[model samples]
Target: MSTAQLVSLTLAMLAGAVTLLGLVIVTGRALHRRRTRRDARLAADFRPLLLELTGGDDDIDEPLRRLAALDRRRWRAVEPSAISLLTKVSGHAHAALVSLFAQRGLARAALRDLDRFGAVRRATAAHVLGLMGHTEAAPALAGLLSDRSPEVRAVAARALGQIGAAEAADPLLASLAAGGGVPFHLVAQSLIRLGPGARPALAKALYHPEAAVRAVAAEVLGLTGAVETARVLIGVLAGDPSGEVRVRTARSLGRLGTPVCLEALIHATGPAHPHAVRVEAATALGDLGSPRAVPALCDLLGDPQYHVAHNAARSLARLGSGPAMAVLAETVAERPGTTAAGHAWEALAVLDLQAGQLRRPPTAPVS
Candidate 1:
């Protein structure tokens, strides 16, 4: 064919493709709208019954029976709302919902969906299992932590936490290494949800090769109130090579607040440690709330590192002991031009403001 003829044919085919694409888009939107309307109708019909059952105010037996007997389409329509409430309701309402889900075989179905090829299906299943608090599905959910999809991994991590799967703690910590796309905050939250039962695992994670994992494990240990792991955290605070990890460890030790951690936290505040580590350590000393920390914290007030000295003064105030306050007062009076004095003045001013607020009379309500 001649060049002009070939070009004209190409344009004709492009026009036809564009027209076909527009038709497909219109058809897809039409179908989605229809589906949405159907879902809305179903939700309106059934969601009230669910609310009544979960509300714990009325007779739940009737609502529970109706929900349990729902046909597949109706159940599908209401499933999202039910799952959404799983995390919100508690006491009898929460228990009733779990029983309803089990009677409907949702737990088993969600377990199967965990292995589905679609990422959304896998994530949704993980979410359902987690919300249902299905302990039996914990292992399957744990497997999804390493799934190819980042979202699936995140959902799986969350589910494992909700399920209280202590076994999954190690894997959750490991996911923080190089290629694990899961957010560190999510992992930490899950570990915390796992509670003290995961402390043994979290304590074990303190020695993990990855610094990120170690840091998270240390922080979660403190948040979970794993006072038993104070020694472990103290060691981490003193010897961990990563400054970030050491900082977290010091903070955790402070939260643990065992007197055993005092030497380690004080040592961490020394100039030998990183500035960040020293700052966290100084703050942690206040959290420790030990009068013994008074001397070390007073010394920290003199450190050239502004943040370290600043935190030290605050920690001294937090100690709330006469000696600690005396140090702050003396620093303010004797070291007027110094960094220590500035921090001391701020702490004393805050104390005075708090005292004034306490002494103020309560305002009567307007009629």
Candidate 2:
């Protein structure tokens, strides 16, 4: 063929391919819309029956049987909304939903999906199983924590948490120990969802061989505000070799707010402690709102770490005594244009606001 004819032919083929791609995209979008509408209609039809089932007054065996008769597509639409209500309701209502899931074999179906090669499929399966809150699915979900997919592992941890079975605690902790891609924060959240039942395991974790595990355990215990673990946490703060663990322990100790916790925090703020530990300790003392912390917090204002000085100033504002106020004023005057000065000025304002003195403090130029 001539050169001009060859060029023209190539251009025609490119145009055809672009047209085909556009057609496929449009067709896919149209199908998605149709599926969404169908799902919405099915959800509306099931809403009333699901609400009635949640009331738990009537015999639900018949309703559950009827629900189980739904085709897979319709059941998929209804299950998400059902689980949404299940999460909000407890007692008989929650039990009714679990019974419904069992009658429909949803948990079994989810378990089968856990073995699927697809990541999204495995994650969704883990979510559904978790929502069912059935103990039978816990082992399968626990196994997924070792899956190659990070997304799948995270979802499985969440599912284990939602199940709230104490048996899942050790498995979850093991996953943390194995050091897969699963984030410590997600694992910590899962443990928190297990409630007080997980406290003993978490306390044991405070002494885990991995410093990360011990640090996370301290953080989770503090969030739980379980006073029973305060002594253990104080010990960790005082002696744990890991500076990160000591920092987390200091924060948790502040959340605990016991007399012993206060004492431990005061010791942590000492110059001998690591800078990170001292910073968190000073911050926690402010959170405790104890007048006894005033002296220690004041001493922290001259800490070499700017963060420690800033936090100490803020805590003094929280304490709101004449001595604390005097320290803030001095820091603001002596360290003008520095971060410490800014913190001191802000602390004075916070004190004024709390005292119903809303007038703006005299401005100093910040460098």
Candidate 3:
């Protein structure tokens, strides 16, 4: 064949391929739109029945049994909206939804999907089981902590947290140690969800070799408000070699708001501590809202780190101490148009407003 003929054939083939691809794209979009409309209609149809189920209205057993009898595709269309109501309802309504989930064997289905190849599938399954609040699913969720995918691990951790199972605590801590890109904050939140039940495991984690683990543990403990953990956090602030851990500890101590924690926070603001630690300590001291921290906060107002100095000045003002107000006034006068000066002025305004509130007389009640 001639070169021109060959080129013409190739161009025609390429044009056909592109046209076919466009057709496929359009078809897929059409199917998706149809599916979305169907799901929306199903959701609307189910909304009243689900609301009645959650409302604890009479004769729900037949309606619930009818719902459970729905075909797979129809139920799939309704499931997302149904589960979404779990977060919206509470008390009898919540229990009824949980019963619905159980009766439909959703927990079992999700438990089976926990080991699915797709990360999205596994994550979705974990979420459903977690929201179901089924303790029987905890073991499966715990196993997903070691999943190869970081996203899967994170989702599983969150699921375990929502379950708030004491047994899941150790596995979650162990995952933190393994550290395959699972965020410290996510792990901390999960531990926090377990409340005091997770305290022992988190306390042990504070002694882990990795500073990240220790920091997470301290932060979670503070969030839990486990009063007994304050002493451990104070020790970390005083002696943990990692400045990051110390910073986290200082912050945790502020959340704990114990008298000893106040002492540790004051010591942390001292010049001997690292800049980051001191900055955290300054911020934490503010969180404590203690008059005792004023002198230490005043001293930190001249820190070399502008943030530390600014935070110290701001905290002092929040403390509403006479000493703090004087320090703020001095800072505003000494440095103009700087962060420290700005925080000082802001702090002064806050302090004055607080002072006004304190001095305001109680209004007489109408007879």
Candidate 4:
């Protein structure tokens, strides 16, 4: 080959290589510049929506929809790199959108946005989906309950609880594994929010390895009056590691008023027990108006705590059987000036059907 021909070929190859390198550098710079501009735009876009809603606009959901579409379609094309940033920005938009939908009573519209942008997997997006009560997103958000980030998992668990849909229980249940901290409280409250949806999960949670979780589960189930969960409450009355938890469980079981739980309540009233819990359980039995519990309550009439004796007297009056009446009359006669005596007078006022009234006639039940 000729020297000039070879030299021309060499220079042409090196030039092509340099040209390629220069193009890549320019592309990198373009991406950087575009990203910076897009972030600013996202913040700007979020501001108007936030201010408009907070400024008391009656409705801005329609406009928010248009704004979201601009990201999902246009900006995502010119800057395909912007999808993630845009999706996260869309979550803040949805938080505002929820209020508009509620004000307009547009359930369908709210669900649509949740089902769409909620897939972004950002904490803000999870929260928006939750506030919207999107049941369909349970499986997706449920996966976030153990997210490496506590904030993300907390939002997901909290949202599931608010959703209160049966589908969300499993994920909320999984959140119980979160050791002692804000996550535990967040998860427990969400399950409690479910009410009926939370019963089975709470019943299972009673057996959690963490005593704190188990204890909170019992109290929550009791507050929920999940009669179906009575067995768990009764079981926790004994062998539970925490005194506060057991005390609460006893009171809850007492409220259940089932004969099956009476034994547990009586057992919990031992001298070692919290006075408040023992008194509540005894009062609950008395309220149940069971003749069978008269002996135990009569025994408590002499309890060291004035409150205990008072509750015992009140329960005896409610039972209305001859033995309860006799036992109450004896206590009042024996200790007329003590606090128990004061409570005895109050008990008569409550039942209003006194020993004299019971003696006079076989009246029909009060219903």
Candidate 5:
């Protein structure tokens, strides 16, 4: 063929391909819309039954059996809603839903999906197992903490927490180390969810090599009310090399609120520690609510760091003791125009406002 004829033929083929692509796009969209409508209809039909199961305190066996017996396609349509409600319901409703999921073999399917090649599939499976509160799935979920996908790691962390697996605490803490692909907050919350059962692991984590892990462990120990671990936290506050870890340790020590932590918190508030550590230490003194922290907190009221001084004043207010109030009153009366005085005055005002609110009579209801 002549060169001009060849060029024309190529252009015609390109036009045909473009037309075919347009037709495919339209057909795909049409199919997608049809599928969506069908799913919505199925969800609507199933939602009331699901709601009846989850909302009532009455017999759930019928609803449970009906839901479990749904055909494959119908079950798939309602499964997402069921999973979404898992965390929202409680007591009999929750047990019924979990039973329904188990009866449908969802937990087993989800466990299998935990090893799926697709990250989204793995994450979704982790979520489903978590909402099901599947204890058996804990180990596999913990394994996903080091998954290549951050999202998968996060889902697994959350699932382990939902399952209340105390053993997963260590791996969750480990995930806080460099490149663990999980957020520190997620791990901490999960650890908190594990509750006091994970205290041993958390205390051990206080010694983890990674500072981030150590820091989160310290923070969680206090939040989880692990009073027995207060001494370990005190040591961390006094000697941990990581400033962030020391700061968290101080706060945790305060939350632990043992009188033994008082000296360590006081020591942390001294000039030897970083200002951040001192700030948290001062704040922790307030949380400790010990009269012994009064002197240390009062001294902090004059620290060069505004936050240190401000938190010191606030903590003294938190103490809510005669001596603690006297210190604030003295600071306000004698240290006028200083940073200490300003914070002290603010603290006093807050206290007075609280007092006034307490004394004020409740308004009578309208006739």
Candidate 6:
């Protein structure tokens, strides 16, 4: 071989070896830093709020209370800590700020940092920006909806919802259009956060052929109290392929607070309704707070599924707490104390009745 060829081969091998070694070293340092950083960040972030919850930080409580009251200046005081608190992988500081960032100003700052120069920065930035409603960043975030990375796209969608851009409703609604193709949970959440702006697109989604999208649309409509969609869903309740969609329709009907919705919920609780659908339907009946739902709800006490039994029993107690207290007492007698029993007690509590202790009954008498 020529001398130049020999020299070239040797140089290539050395460069390849150097690259491999450098990658290994970088990976090791990254893993090591990650482990220690989590605890250290929490220790630093909470150093200021240590006394707020305990009521021991008299000096800090007033300021903490002021912050809790949605003070933007309070965040400026803890800005770095606030950002760290939001980005910290886990711990009490993160938990403490979950509700705080729901306020506007800090949410905007997070949106601003979403384009920060790294993955971790982007992830945390995406979370806070999507949840806090940064209207100003809507266009920039919308551009990221098509990001090559799935994580980036997902977070961008989330941030768009937080920004509550009416413009984003069309995109998110389109994602749910085919139902099977898009991520349904993320679409549902974004639609929900889009709130009033999403009502039009969500109403259209209600008629989508995809059962999942229709079901989610019904759920969002109910949550947002979209009374206008009631008539449209009623038409769908008759023959929609999925029982879940029909069940969601029943629940949304109940949310509309029309007396007609009670009948729809009653009809939906039949054997035709899936077990999970029946639970939501029954719960919707309770939210309706009508005397009419009591009998059907009472019948659900014997449902084979425990969740349905619980929801039905609770609904009956709500309508009958004053006159139906005996009925609820009887349900607890037959089934024993459970979540339904808890709701029954709470219903009684609302009726000005005292429930000092929950009672446990003897097992059924043997034949």
Q: 1-367, model 1: which lDDT tens digit per residue?
A: 9999999999999999999999999999999999889998998899889889888775788999999999999888898889888889888899999999999998898888988899999999899888888999887876787899999999989888888878878788878977587889999999999877788888888888889989999999888888888887888877889999998888888898899999988888888888999999999999999999999998888889899998999999988959999999898777766778788888877777877843222233355
Question: Using Cα atoms with residue i matched to residue i, what is each candidate's TM-score against the true structure?
Answer: 0.89, 0.81, 0.83, 0.54, 0.92, 0.60
What is the RMSD, in Å, between candidate 5 and the native fold over all Cα?
6.2
Which ten contiguous residues of candidate 1 have the minimum total lDDT? 357-366
145-225: candidate 2 lDDT, tens digit per residue: 999999999999999998998877777877777466679988889989989998888999898998878888899899998
Looking at model 6, report the run of 10 residues with the lowest lDDT sum.
50-59
Q: 1 or 4: which has the higher lDDT? A: 1
How many steric overlaps are in each model, in order? 0, 0, 0, 0, 0, 2
lDDT of each: 0.87, 0.86, 0.82, 0.66, 0.87, 0.67
Query: Candidate 3: which pairs clash?
Result: none
lDDT of 5 by residue, 237-334 (tens): 87889999998888888888789898888888888879899888889889999998888888888888999999999998988869999999888778
Tell me the alpha-carbon RMSD of every candidate.
6.3, 4.7, 7.1, 14.8, 6.2, 9.6
Candidate 4 C-alpha error for residue 337, in Å: 3.1
Off by over 4 Å in 1: 1-17, 57-59, 353-367
| Model 3 weakest lDDT span, ten residues long | 357-366
Pick the TM-score winner.
Answer: 5
Candidates ranked by lDDT: 1, 5, 2, 3, 6, 4
Comparing 2 and 4 on TM-score, the stronger one:
2
Instruction: Quote the positional error of residue 25 for candidate 3 in Å.
Output: 5.1
What range of 10 consecutive residues in model 4 has the weakest lDDT sum? Answer: 78-87
Clashing pairs in 4: none
For the record, the alpha-carbon RMSD of candidate 4 to the native fold, in angstroms, is 14.8
